[model samples]
Target: MSPARVGRVAVLAAALGALAGAGAGWWVDPGGDGTRPALPATAAAGRPSSFAGADASWRGASPGLDAAHAAPSDLAARRTGAPRGAVGTPELQALLRAPPSALRASLKTAMRHRDQGGWLYARALARQCVLLEMTTLHEGTAGLAPVDLNQPLAQRVSAWREQLAAGCAQLQPEELREAMNVPAAASGTSATPGTLDGADPLIQLMDRPAPPGSAAARERLAAILNRADPLMLSELGPALLQREGEAFVFDGRRLAGEDERRALEAATMLLPCALGLACDERDERVWGPCVMTGDCRHATREEAVLAATDADAGLDAGPAAPDRRAAVRAWVERLREAVLARDVDRFLRPPG
Candidate 1:
């Protein structure tokens, strides 16, 4: 087979393998047997759980019950001014950015440190990785290819699965059991009745500020956006841009100023990719012609967006085809720059 054909075959195989693994309950229930009680419909809809109103102090509390008494690690001692549980350290960043081949070792290193929020951060990262892989598999099968032979992708899926299982094992039983007991009302989903599910841990954290208008809430939003991985961005960006009575809101307050407006526009353009990767796998806005034509040229969401024509409509509407594609490409570039710069402020600033 030609190299392109080989690539397509690999993707198809990976998708099948991933789907099979998911069916076997490896991906869906990595922590145990697939017998855990389903979260209430309200909770699944992103309503704040009954637990959302819990004391604000606990949200930022030391990770472990005895964490306060534990001596700081040499790494923690050296990083002055860093937040107690911050995950942005250079070492952790390196681990987060590590390739799949190196992921297991990186996860092991990340999971070893319980102080300074290392383990929590690691769990979040692992969970994100698993979700992203599942998204990739769905996209691959739905639009790109149709077969199960890719060893590398299968290995990656396996690695993330194992890491997630390891992370879950470290969680206290109560934490594991009660994490999703959040009530729909507390989720804010009860009030708005939107499709965005805030059940994901990172998304929950981003949306769970005690008093939504507080300075601490703003700081938390900025911190998470600044440090967010691509999957996190795909999930959180759209949630931040959610509309309420003629204005966009992040954490419930209307977006303020030109900077926030710019962020909203970027998030709007990001929706198709977000839908593909983090929201709805079956959304036609994400699938494009590949779903029908089976040509599968656009393997990635960026490619799909840039390849989109006026006929594709939706967000790609208004401007001429080339202009719309250019706009998306520009936003994609701006997003890349902001992520690389590691600054939410840069993300809000108008692109030069």
Candidate 2:
């Protein structure tokens, strides 16, 4: 393999490792309890993992997932029984054109036009959003009508969505206060740190139940988006749209002033590319000879990318970088507007 190929394979391996278990225990205690269960210790490494592609024969879907394979938000194109083909590059291009700020709104608006049952995952997942304090809207303790399967499927899906939406919308402000440790007034604050300039398509195709034969959607999606403008596609996906409804707005509570805009520009500069960290894969997975020893901690792929980007820019690695916090705030607010209002142009900005 050429040096570039070798490096790509190594970063792919490191990223795969991070996705598998690096963040498993990295979660916050959502309940604010002294009582949440502790994350299990990292398991002992088992058989050494290799990059050899598996046989296509072992690639079949699990029982219920065997139905259609369109991405969860493809409302008009029900996956009912379509054999999963490669996700269209154009579809990904459209996605990459979306910036982090508009991610949730873009998704929610798309959901409005969706065919029934297209986002089945949301039914079970909706209430959990509140417990996690993901709601910007209210959900109340009200009775929802029981479902009747004999009802037309659209009726059933619409009713379910309405119930979920109302529940999210009906929560008292106090509930948000009780749920999130952060102040209820600051709704735009992010729970996840380091994601603003972290990975692109943070999840890989293999990271999720991607259609059996598609390339990693994030990489393909990032490429098509940045091809013209060189920076798009930074938010998480339709899953957030399904559950949060209007509450899923990224963050539009306040606009950045001139100073804040300058801070945002600094933050945006720190991004590995407007394209995302996914484009910068290289052998540099942290400092001081750790990848060979396997004893390093604090060296997940996100850490590696941050370190590599800093090194490439002749920056240092100690405290957080300039505008790190501000960047996240700006990014979230950007998503808020796109998700809430019906402005498609917000989703189409050229990378700065």
Query: Per-residue lDDT tens digits of candidate 1, residues 15-93?
Result: 3433242211212322244321111101000000111122232223222112122222334343322222322353443
Local distance difference test, candidate 1: 0.36
| Candidate 1: residue 65 lDDT (0-100) | 18
Candidate 2 local lDDT, residue 298: 25
lDDT of 2 at 334: 46
RMSD of each: 16.0, 23.6
What tens-digit string does per-residue lDDT give for candidate 2 at 1-352? 6454344334333333333332222222223442221121211110001102212321232111122222334433333321122122223323222222232332442324322211111211222223222111112313212334353432323333333344334333333222222121222123232232221222221123323113433333333333222112221221222112222211332223543433333222222222222111110122111212222332223333333333333444545554443353344344333432434333332223
Which lDDT values do the candidates have, in the order given?
0.36, 0.27
